[model samples]
Target: MAKADGLDLIAVGRSCVDLYGEQTGGRLEDMLSFAKYIGGSPTNTAVGASRLGLDAGLLTRVGEDHFGRFIREQLAREGVDTRGVVADPARLTALAFLGIRDPDTFPLVFYRENCADMALEAGDIDPAFVASARAVLINGTHLSQPGVFAASMEACRLARAAGGKVVFDIDYRPVLWGLAGKDAGENRFVADAAVTARLQQVLPLCDLIVGTEEEVHILGGSTDTIDALRAIRERTPALLVCKRGAQGCSAFADAIPDSLDQGVVGRGFAVEVFNVLGAGDAFMAGFLRGWLRGAPLAECCEWANACGAIVVSRHGCSPAMPTWEELQAFLRDEARPFRLREDAALEHLHWATTRATGYPSLTVLAMDHRSQFEALCERTGAAPERIAGFKSLALRAVDRVAAGDPGFGVLLDGRFGMRALEAAAAYPYWIGRPIELPGSRPLEFESSADVATELATWPANHVVKCLALYHPDDPQELRERQERQLLRLQDAARKTRHELLVEIIASRGGEVAEDTAARAIERLYALGIRPDWWKLEPDDRAGAWRGIEDAIVRNDPHCRGVVLLGLSAPQDELIASFAAAAQAPIVKGFAVGRTIFADAAEQWFAGTIDDEAAIDDLARRFAILVEAWRDAKQRAQTQAIRETA
Candidate 1:
């Protein structure tokens, strides 16, 4: 039986990579580009459930390859537990090529010869793990093959023995069962008595059964929908759900209804269908979300229908599933558009919620200084052109310090550091480029007033770092101007699909309260500006850091936590700040500049140190800060563990 704190659901079978053609209303042969996403019936359901706030796990096998690792990592990012997801050394992961030919026709081709997922054996089913979930869901495709069928049946037996419900999704794929040609991946139904008999053998063990109209027809071995329901009911007393496409879904608990309209019906939403590939999987996920919580049948069907509606109007499968917050907002808003894809607010919500990279910590080298570098060159009697070469050398130092560490990043400007930025683009490091004009009090863009047009030319990996010299106590007109500029930048970042990092320096406006920075952040939130990252001046006081953390969490929990910025503070002072900020979990890492680079730059400009010597010195200094930041984080973690103990 499932323990009180065990997982909510475990989905077994069919994990694959889906390469969806980007061009709509085009055949697969004519498509030019494709967007990759994790797919497969059970995998999509697991991702959908996790996104909708369920403690979901996936039980499947992926090959030992790049795509396999990608599938596992993506699943973890979506909050699905992957303990049961095995990596097979013998086979390759499956791939599905799909194109949206039109609203109704989606061409699909599966490259599944000797795929790892289909090689699942009964021995792979861990009884304890199977019992750890309150419900175990197995799709019909797994039962089409002998080895996977054994594994699926074993999971069902273990789940039932441990008092867990078994959920059956008649995920009928005719090509998978060899009833159709290899190219007929989109073929939903193909009547074969043998396939129906095989499905009937597993139907009696299910506690709940869900399928589209065509799927139920195959399961019940009948051409009629009502007749299929009756046939399926005789085998088991499971709660049967019939997916009626645009008409929503119908549920039957006690008896098979004479007609679907007579049963408990959940009305569907009015939305244009873009692609119907993974809609059923999404519907099952939404239904399970409510059913596991003991919600009413009508409520479960409502979520299911809404989820289906939303996915059908969007592009990819798992990526299209709505988060719990998005789902609730859509349900609550009476003015939502009939075509969900046309709703800008909902689209932004979906994009923001679903597309965050998993960067736990970032140690950045902030050398985006323009005026300072030029001034140093002038003071040393060196040509202004030397500044560009110096920025490139600084990038080399960054490369040395951040070699294999994905957590390291660089903040470079395009004016003098364009060469460095171009070189840094080749690496997988977190690259941020400054958008705010240097030391601009009202936050003016360096290139143009139109931020979106400027952002369109930037590489996708470069984060938009805008340093806002903001203060809550500023004169109303000045503060509003700065806020307006920030709002424009935020919108531009969203449109360009670039992450925005708003660096707040509240002290720039003069003497202020300890909570001044936090207040400025709160003011921005009030103006509907939600940055993906917040770069703030580090405070040595724990209370000040906590205030900033509280504001960020209260406003946008999805906002990537803050990174401390150095305002040319001495190395010792920066380290001290790290210790203080480390105590706040919201402070991720530091983006320090002058403390590591000023002395090196000055020496190199004055001919006191050669390029090699300067690079080595800068690398050493940056490494020291990285080590100090890590030590402080370790200490903070230890103290937290001690407190909890």
Candidate 2:
């Protein structure tokens, strides 16, 4: 089979940031924290489609600010093409502050007055790119404004001219339409002929039209749902899908006959609704996922209902769309009620897995050691105060590498590198912080789950890097103690919404450290401690990493792939280890510390080199390691391609 061309689906219109209240059944004022997720109808649909292995792209505008960068990065991380998305320097990115009181009602505030996405002009769109997609999906909110309306029409014209299907999701928000103000309720009903005419103008261009009952009523220029469906069908020879919330949905087409009352209604999944924020978008994506793959209407509707069911039972919008494996598993099991975050099965679905789009591999700089770094400095007769300074030098090196955009992460400790932690989190680089007490053997900590307090407040995107030194042949009592301590951290991770990155290193006296490290992960899995990421000691042989990979796959396929740790190894030895790791697909990245910055740290601490010299040296060494890893990964890919040929 020939390789497929990219951009099968292009979604246009509004894209915004959603700040969802973390605490349920509370007023927005009372909620102390909120989780951030990408929001907006068309954006969510694009992300959902991408999650189902579709080549999706987005066309919108975001502010040239932090939020805008976040929107772009998040979309790109999901494999959504963001080249068509523009960064409007003049306007701020749109934001929605939302709270859920119950299953029936969700209070939402649109902070999108003259926002960037709405500022999208006809000139902002690329006609060729719009025409390239097999289907162009557009939301109705863009029709409310002159500039966005013109752009949406141009896109429709381009897609239709190129023999591409135009899909219209009647995403009618009264507040978005300016028919209702910020406080006039999130869900509003308004029937206006002018709005209907505006929508009807593009009906002939659409091959598929999807809308809820109220949305259909508004666009069809009718008060009744049945009449709304008939009116829409009369105008366009498109397939009409009317979503009826818990009653499932009905799809009507000219070929389906008019004698039927509601047409072909897809059976709905009776999930205990958590929040119905993105169900419609999920439904559209699921329908497209099946339809694009040549499935029949009934099967397409099944996928749509399942996708909607999973999202409504979760917290966030776009991020809550289930992966392909997750959807299959959810559909396969006919078990009891599944709760989000509370149930292990549902929690492992990985709705928030950050897949690489432009850059899949990460070259992490691990400078998080507190006790170890202090000890090394003390032995060299360097001032203790230089620990933070050494960390700062390492951070500067990280900054230089991040500028180039082959993914990178920084691991730091709170004792000295807290400033670096705060700084790195703001950038696109992945941020990780050590949770273990300084130099704890057998995984002992100063207090029981002290990191839990910090974990609760830490941003969700950042990783909690916890280290534990364990020996496979250790005494029973010591082994039991370590397991219990790890269990505490695991429980804390579950409660605090932090993705745990556990670093497992074997005790020095063990048999072949790599084998010991592989077994350690299996032991952790057996103890029911499944982390999102594993930081393992580098292996000398490529095949030696296979056991570790197998253990991770068995424990949690959703587990983010492992990263190779430096283990304070010599530069040449560490480079060899990284070369070996590059051959394993499961080793997603490397977290080499001493190999990248040890000499520079020593020189800076001993006052042999100035801060700038130390920083430049660290950057030099880090870059060399990065180049080595990239070369190895490239060679491995080439070998695989040759083998296939």
Top candidate by TM-score: 2
lDDT of 2 by residue, 214-233 (tens): 99989989877777777887
lDDT of candidate 1 over 1-645, digit per residue (tens): 235667999999999999999788878999987778899999999999988989999999999998999899899879898999999999999999999998889999999999999999999988888888999999999999999999999999999999899999999999999989988899999999999999998887899999999999999999899999999999999999999999999999988867899889985798988999899999999999999989899999999999998999988898899988899888988888887898877876787788656678899999899999888988999888888888899888988988868798899999999999999967778889999888898779998658888998898779999998888999999999999999989889876678999998888897767788888889898888889889999888888888999999988877778999999999988898898899988888988889999998999999999999999999999999999999999999999999999
Which candidate leads in lDDT? Answer: 1
**TM-score for each model:** 0.78, 0.87
lDDT of each: 0.90, 0.81
Prediction RMSDs, each to the true structure: 5.3, 3.9
- Quote the lDDT for 345 in model 2: 68
